[model samples]
Target: MEALNLTSSGPTTFILNGIPGLEAAHIWISIPFSVFYIISLLGNFTVLFVVAKEQTLHKPMYLLLCMLALTDIGTSTCIMPKALCMLWFGSKYITVDGCLTQMFFIYMIAIMHSAVLVTMGFDRYVAICDPLRYATILTNARIAKLGLVGLIRAVLLVLPLPLLLRRLPFCANRVIPQTYCEHMALVKMSCGDTIMNRMYGLVLTFVIMGSDLTLIGLFYGLIIRAVLRISSKKAHQKALNTCSAHICVMVITCATSLFPALTNRFGQGIAAHVHTLLANLYLLVPPMLNPIIYGVKTKELRDKVGKYTCRM
Candidate 1:
């Protein structure tokens, strides 16, 4: 069994504080979480299947949509199984290696999801801003290459984290305060100094996610400008409507992720937990809601899903 090594001289035991006035909180959350998990799984699977089955969706946009669905499935799978276990069994203690492994996959998928969003932004930019060159710019070969590059970058960026965690000399406190194996939370339990881990984390965040966010913002800015220059009122409305879903996703993700990091740095535990909950929501909510959003917002996907489901 994997165990966290604590640095203290005496025997160590872990105790978790049961929440006051929220004895049923776990039960309450479980109901919606279970529902969302089912919906998210089915919805994302349908997306993957529809994209694979339909030759028409072989284009760049649908390819990115498929990638997004895959990432969503991955992200939720990493967290929900353990989360549900915690809810049902009231067991939150995770072994050291297990925690590190969980952290690795969670961060990997989260970063990859962000990278895919940047790719999606570029897809929209080319489709809208450079309509004349969209086909040439985002060809099948190019899309495939982009996917490969995203996968490579995600792996490379997260590779160091687990190695770094393993190198740390953990002193006695093996118990993680949070339900899930969050990277910073694990580091916090360490009795030794975690300056290196913190520094590495900061570098990874800014280098990968920060850069991607900047590029995505730039792409959308150009897209908005291009949209504004259009002469027809109906065309402008259509363009804005198409952009809204992605914009909402971007805002939700960034706010959830960035806020927690900030609050943690400021040593605000309650604020950090709230942000963590929001971040978890940001991760799950989009996956659950994306299909619904796209279905209601985009006539093509909605019609396709409806027809496909009806046939089934």
Candidate 2:
């Protein structure tokens, strides 16, 4: 309910340091980043297209996969282009408004990604534990509402961040030591009392993401217990296989995302370039890997992709 609408003694333009000590390798670095970006685009778009064309894939699980593809697209697109621009062309300056807008979308997608994973976890839990009610419980309307709630949660929580920054007086040290505008990075730039900013950001991130991951783990724990109760070994194997891909994705996304945040906040002995590099990789890994994991693991989607590829 509080608002910080006044702009303070902060610089209107902020400089994004692409990499602290690797300016020369910036061009070389662009190569791999570009590859990851292209792969993410192709892979995610393929999933969206395949899901759209195949009517039989219109169930809750596949609908959730489409949501994952969209968020994956968002996650990479939000970070990669700005980073690539800084790397390739040395265009590292961002306006305060520009910086704030970028921060909103980046963190929004990050939150939504966690929510989608949580929803997917719920979907699996229902499918594994309450198979008879899976369809009835997760109708199209329910899925849409869940996605909408995630969007609303992300927006309401992240909206205050930029507004909070507006109230702070940033010193003349306007160089942000990364390729993109991150919340803590921007907060650290301020010379004013930013206890509120730090507290809000920490709570927003740790609470939302931490709870999502915990729910995912809990979902799997229940799923594993249910599978064990099955008398047939073959049935247990089938159930485990169904969850393997989603769990693998959660592990990859969870580690890559959390580690960089940890490195950003508390990695005192860590080098500046290490933080920058990890942040860049953090943005790239999940998008590039998600569709591939699903494509390999989900048989129906895999078959559709294979048939589409063969026709191509």
Candidate 3:
């Protein structure tokens, strides 16, 4: 589908309205983003490689990690290539269809990432909360099923967004201010009121992100309660350590998703941009850091990665 020409005022135009004092900001942003992109790619690839090669790490936890790496890689690949292209090539004019497609995949992956995090939380809870039944509850077949369900869910949840946009009469401006076509941002550009789009988006936010966060909170809370009752210091410490990486990931994801909306509501453009940068970081930084977090904390992954790399 062609990009919706909704701009009522005229044909959508993307003029670079240069921000004062931010002349060098693009350069600064590009440097860090480039570094983050490289790290994210390398780190996730390493995780994927190690998990694929090491038979010992073929358990549920590592399987979930492989999924996480795959999602992270998908996320960075979605945003970074276009972003870097804009920075290096000075090409920011995306067609309406291209913009919609970008939004679709980005939203799909983001929702899927959240779902995967929730699944990981559940996996941890089962391992800690019901160790005796963990194996039976999270079997290889079950994990495969859960993963397939997550994939379908993400696609289903985000697919309708573009269709909804396609239904809207494009009477006005086509130029999106941001580098990427965010759903809400595009909706805002509509000449006609977008009450239905907003309502749908709110419902989606509650269902996908809100539900995932609630489940993650419950899982962590239960884990905390379980850990407190354990008498052995080492046992409690080990349980907490297992959760550290997930907790960091959760915090980053939540901040990235929630903060921008809040800042935008308050009319803070700079804050919104900062939030955008943080949102990108949630995809890039956490993925890059995940390997380090797991490797430093888990002796098994660390040893395996070192041995595996040394052999090469």
Best by lDDT: 2
Q: Is candidate 1 or candidate 2 better by TM-score?
A: 2
Clashing pairs in 1: 6-171, 6-172, 7-171, 7-172
Quote the lDDT for 102 in model 3.
83
| Model 2: CA > 4 A from native | 1-10
lDDT of each: 0.75, 0.89, 0.76
Q: Order of all candidates by lDDT, from best down to worst? A: 2, 3, 1
Over 4 Å off in model 1, which ranges? Answer: 1-24, 267-276
Writing each residue's lDDT as its tens digit, candidate 3 over 1-312 gives: 243453453344442212223435876677888998898888889888998998888898888888888888888888788777776666767766677788898889888888789999999999888999999899867877888899999999899899888767654455455556678777766766678888888789778877888999999999999999999999998898888888877776677667665554455556445645655665567666766776776678889899978988
For model 3, name the residue pairs that clash: 3-96, 3-97, 6-170, 6-172, 7-171, 7-172, 7-173, 8-171, 8-172, 8-173
How much is 92 displaced in model 2, in angstroms? 1.3
TM-score (C-alpha) between model 3 and the true structure = 0.89
Candidate 2 lDDT over residue span 70-174, tens digit each: 999998898888888899899989888999999999999989989999999999899989999888999978998999999999899889998898878777778
